[model samples]
Every structure is written in C-alpha cells, then in structure tokens.
Target: MSASPRARRMTGAQAGAVTARILSAAVGGYALAYAATAFLSVYLPMERPDRVSFASLASFFVWVATILYVFAARSAWRATWVPLALSLLLGLAAFLPGGYGVRP
Candidate 1:
C-alpha cells in the first residue's frame, strides 16, 4: 500500500533517518556477532596464537559506528555524505577481508 496523502511527501532528511534505522539494526547485529567471536578468541585457550582472528575486533568497531546511520534512518536525520561513505568503506573493510574468519 502506498503511503497516505499526508505521508506521501517525504523530505530527503526524513528518508535518511529511516535508512539509518535499518542500517543501524543491521550493523548492530554484525557488531554483536563479531564481539562474541572476538571474545572467544582472546580469553579462550588457543593452542596457536597465530590462529587468532585479528580482524574480528576491528570489524566490531567499524560496525558499531553504523549507529549514526541507523539514527539518521529512523528519525528523519539529514542525509550526510561523509557518514554514509565512511560506513560503506568500513563495512567493506570489515566484511570483505577474510582476516576475521577462523575455522576449527
């Protein structure tokens, strides 16, 4: 269903907020998962330190920054080019590299 007439018009600012919210949720989930993985790598006994997933913690930090995107998306936040770009770059850096993956 289309939006109501009253809701028909959405300014760029308003749209940005909604986008931010969605991004926030997605990034937050990523961060949590990364953190959990990183936690196990650090405290858990590891026979080989070389097997540690070094990138996982860095990925967590990048994902955490997505909160700004989420905030902008959910609450009609203005569309800022810099934050969006940063988020994308960070996401790629964190997700594209296999530096964070560890397998049994």
Candidate 2:
C-alpha cells in the first residue's frame, strides 16, 4: 500500500529496516565518542564530552534519527514505539523554546 501523507512516509516493513539502520548508526557514533572520551579522559575530564560541542551534537542527531526511524515503523513496530513516544514527549518539551510537553 502507498504511504499516506499523514501516515509515515515508509511502509511498516521499510520502517523496521530503517530503524535497524538508525540503531546501527547510533551505536557506531556512540562507540566512536566513547573511545574518544576514554582516551581523552586521561588528559582532560571536561573535554571528554558531557559538555563538548561534538558530543552534544552527536547525541542530538542520534535522538532525532531514532525518533524519525522509530516513528516511521509504528505500524508493525509496536515493540519499538513506547520508547519513541517517550522521546517525543521529552523532545516536545526540550524543543520549541517554552512549548508545552506532548500529551498522550
């Protein structure tokens, strides 16, 4: 079936595949940062990542990618949806300046 504009742009199966890609990418990115932090922590704790630019940016991208990929899989990916919803709620609050949090 064709995807509805209001409905996600991907089919359920496609969504699942996309989620896998997103997860893999996220894991790879995190591992890279983790290794960087591990090596750098020895010389500088603050520079390790919690407040650094690249760390925060990577985290933000990971979050966005996860959300998009997960939500796209909502049709057949019931198992992956709960976390997506929670993330959406938190994202709503965090973004949009002072916008209200998402309601269930």
Candidate 3:
C-alpha cells in the first residue's frame, strides 16, 4: 500500500512545485479569468447585459480550466508563465484600441 500523505516525504523540489501550482492556480488563474472576461465582454457581439452575463459565465470555466492546467502541467514554470502571459495578452486586447475608458 502507498504511504499516507503525512507519511510521505516530499523533496524540496516537489514541495516547491506544489507551491507554484497552488499559487498559479489561485492568483494566475484569477488574473487570466478576469482578463478573459474583460476581453469577452468587450468583443462578444451581444447586447450589454447579455454580453456581461456570458462573459462572467465563461470566466468561471476559464478559471477552472486554468486550475486544472496548472496542476497538470509538466513543469511548474510552464504553469506559471503560460497563464501570466495569456492574462497580459487578454488584458491588452480588452483595454487597448477600444477607448474603453470613455463609455457613457
């Protein structure tokens, strides 16, 4: 039988990787989800209320998927950087060129 979690010892690298996955799933995933929601809200061609609702709904899935990806990634570094990069890209897409600040 396999050892219990408390009985099993993790190496420093294993612990660090787990920590990175957790942080990436929480913080990075939220950032990515927020960015995706913003981008979708701006670009989805629905009416305002419908667009917002759809984007909000989609963001939940995005967050869950990010969490899964973070844990499933081959390396902690990949998990960390991929979501961060995607969030930045999505944020830029959402905020740039649309003059989003001046909406009446």
Candidate 4:
C-alpha cells in the first residue's frame, strides 16, 4: 500500500533535527556517562575499589538514560544543551580542587 506523500516524507529541517538527535544521543550520552562515572567514583563513600566498580556499573544506566532523554526532548537544541551542561557540571565536580580525591 502506498502512503500519502506528506506522511512518507521528511523535510530538510526534520532530517537535520533527527541527525542532531542521534549525534546527541550517541556522543552526548557517552560524555555524560563518563562525567557521571568520574563524579561517582570520586564522591562515593565506599572503598576505592568498590566505588570504582559501582560507578562503572552505574554509568551504563546513566548513558541509557541520557540517550532516552535526548530522544524525548522537545527539540534537538534542548537535547544537546541539557546533556552538555550536565556533563560539564559533573566533570567539573569530579575534577575540582575542593572535590574528593583532590590533593592539597
């Protein structure tokens, strides 16, 4: 069966939005996961090995959640910026001088 032209077609802006969403889901998700893992590993009160292992495991969930958020967002720009902002915040917290594991 043939679908209507309008139903079957994507405009250029729609394509671009989809592409942006996919890129954000893949790249932004990974970056967010990395930042979350780092932050968790540094801040979790558990022993070093336990914290590392738990953080690594939790990162998988974080990545999956980020991907979902990117797709569910109202716009591609929102998808991109929210994850980027979160990644930066987490990365900063993980690496900042006053954060745990930082030396004097």
Local distance difference test, per candidate? 0.51, 0.48, 0.94, 0.93
Error of 1 at 74 (Å): 8.8
Give the per-residue lDDT of model 1 (tens digit) for 1-104: 87777776778976766666665457554654455445444444555463255545545554656444445452433334434555455445544454657333
List of clashing residue pairs for candidate 2: none
Best by lDDT: 3
TM-score of every candidate relative to the true structure: 0.34, 0.28, 0.87, 0.88
Write candidate 4's Cα lDDT for 2-100 as tens digits.
887678677999999999999999999999999999999888989999999999999999999999999999999999999999999999988885655
For model 2, residues 1-104, the per-residue Cα lDDT tens digits are 97667885668878766666566446533443344433233333454455355544555555555555554554434425444454455444344333444421
Which parts of model 4 are misplaced by more than 4 Å?
1-6, 98-104
How high a TM-score does candidate 1 get? Answer: 0.34
Model 2 is weakest, by summed lDDT over 10 consecutive residues, at 35-44
CA RMSD (A), model 3: 3.7
Task: Report clashes for each candidate as comma-separated counts.
Answer: 9, 0, 0, 0
Q: TM-score of the candidate numbered 4?
A: 0.88
Residue 54 in candidate 2 has what lDDT?
59
TM-score of 3: 0.87
Q: What is the per-residue lDDT of model 3 for residues 1-104, given as tens digits with 9 covering 90 to 100?
A: 98877897889999999999999999999999999999999888889899999999999999999999999999999999999999999998888857757432
Note the residue pairs that clash in candidate 1. 17-72, 17-73, 17-74, 18-73, 19-73, 20-69, 20-70, 20-73, 21-73
Model 4 alpha-carbon miss at residue 74, Å: 0.6
The TM-score obtained by model 2 is: 0.28
List the candidate 2 regions with Cα displacement exceeding 4 Å: 1-9, 42-104
Worst 10 residues of 3 by lDDT: 95-104
Stretches of candidate 1 above 4 Å error? Answer: 1-5, 44-104
Highest TM-score, which number? 4
Misplaced by over 4 Å in model 3 are: 1-7, 100-104
